[model samples]
Target: MDDDEVLLRGRVYGTDDGAPDSRPLPGRSYRELVGGPLDGLLLDVTGWDAGQLSGGAALMTELGRYGGGGRAHYGPRAGDPRCWDWAGDTP
Candidate 1:
């Protein structure tokens, strides 16, 4: 990825009730409860299983469509760089 690529990272922690709260602060327009870099998003849910990852990917894709950019999917890898190119083959 080029220097133009924006890299945003955040984490999600849940309470004993299994509800997510206290996400990373938004640095862009969209109210990202868990993620950022509002444009040209490259999400890596590789930590999750294939099914879970696919579900999150689909959700992100839908959200991206609404947000005006696009979404891509990637598989799990050791020390994968969180950048545009590192985002594996789309779908």
Candidate 2:
């Protein structure tokens, strides 16, 4: 599927056992994703539409710009395309 047609799953940056870890997207929605800062984003989806991915991307951008990590991947394991850049190309 296309990059825009993916259910992007985001994991906010957090500490685990005194170490850095990632947590699931608070609400998995644009509003929820922006609730706070995020550490990174991953496309945790089998299939989705453009709106969903776009929304996730938007939140990722916000998190990245607001001192939160902006790392992104396009795969079930967040390891494709190397990185994500919504600002350069919005859906």
Candidate 3:
């Protein structure tokens, strides 16, 4: 996938808050946050075919795996990490 697609997914999967902030996350590319701050990442898959969704999911899964271990540094800093943790075995 291209850098733009990776960045777009990163932003979408990073934060939950709708509030705007100028502080950029570590290892995050500025190019991704361009076009003014986004309330949330919006993907319009209105006409996407099943194949397309499958492809997109595969891409996202790979991207998530690539960056998965870096979650501590990449995820939201203020909220409970458990909220974003998807690996289970939470205390």
Candidate 4:
């Protein structure tokens, strides 16, 4: 089995003590999300394809203004390859 597809249960960030560390694990890479509710959060982009990295993704967040569940839309920041700019949010 591919470990990449396996889910290792763990604590949710910001909700538990010592449950998980925020730092990226060895060999993992991330992109910084700027602005919006998920500002400052590092998005794990490990194993992403070229298209995925360029197009970005709508990330789920609990801190959305609408309610407890929503997705924050983001796209690659212009001229910033390692950063994503928040476009908007959706419920």
Candidate 5:
């Protein structure tokens, strides 16, 4: 509800199972995925550590590189600190 918080469209997933009603609080926030197959998806950073956040994770998506259910690889964008960028997809 703050001026800085912008509600985005799409599905949100986290380690806790349920998605937050809105953008989470600071350290327990979510990162939006931009470009590629997983665009618009929110990745929960609620309990992610430095390594997990930095190394990134392979997320499952129906729209894969080969056109089927597979994992989409996303990592922190070089200059875009607000969201993660799609690297590629895998089976």
Candidate 6:
């Protein structure tokens, strides 16, 4: 967390599978999606949970799973000042 940085917070539920229940972290999303968060999500976890994320953070990934179809995850990725992906949303 810094002046030029932002943090999207979420609850990490460790699972017996060790893979956990989160997505966007593994699937084919994190590379493009996490970089798009503007980013959790470790793999297919681009959706919502009992958590909070920035506007850009909400824009990318499979947010469809969260915010009841992304009602809470709406906004422009370019306009949001906090909407930035440190990885530049690249693979």
Q: Which candidate is the best by TM-score?
A: 4
lDDT of 6: 0.32
Which tens-of-lDDT digit does each residue in 1-91 have in candidate 1?
Answer: 4442333223321111223432333442211223322234334333455465333332334233344334433332335323222232222
Model 6, range 1-91, lDDT digits (tens) per residue? 4432233333121222334453224333222223333233232234534243443333333323342233223322455433334433221
Candidate 5's C-alpha runs over 4 A off are: 1-8, 14-27
Where does candidate 6 stray beyond 4 Å?
1-19, 30-70, 79-91
Off by over 4 Å in 1: 1-7, 11-67, 78-85, 88-91
Task: Give model 3's TM-score versus the native structure.
Answer: 0.21
- Give per-residue lDDT, candidate 3, residue 50: 50
Candidate 3, residues 1-91: lDDT per residue as tens digits? 4554544443444334343432345453232211212212333334556555333321123233345332111222134321221231111
TM-score per candidate? 0.25, 0.23, 0.21, 0.74, 0.68, 0.21
What is the C-alpha lDDT profile of model 4 across 29-49, one tens digit per residue?
Answer: 678777777676677788999
lDDT of 3: 0.31
Model 6: C-alpha RMSD to truth? 12.2
Clashing pairs in 4: none
Candidate 3: where are CA atoms >4 Å away? 1-39, 57-91
The positional error of residue 79 in candidate 4, measured at the CA in angstroms, is: 0.9
Worst 10 residues of 5 by lDDT: 1-10
For each candidate in the order shown, give its overall lDDT on alpha carbons.
0.32, 0.34, 0.31, 0.69, 0.68, 0.32
Per-residue alpha-carbon lDDT of candidate 5 for residues 1-91, written as tens digits (9 for 90 to 100): 3321233344564322244544345555677888766677678777788888888778876566866668888899888755898898888
Q: How many residue pairs clash in model 3?
A: 0
Model 2, position 86, has a per-residue lDDT of: 40
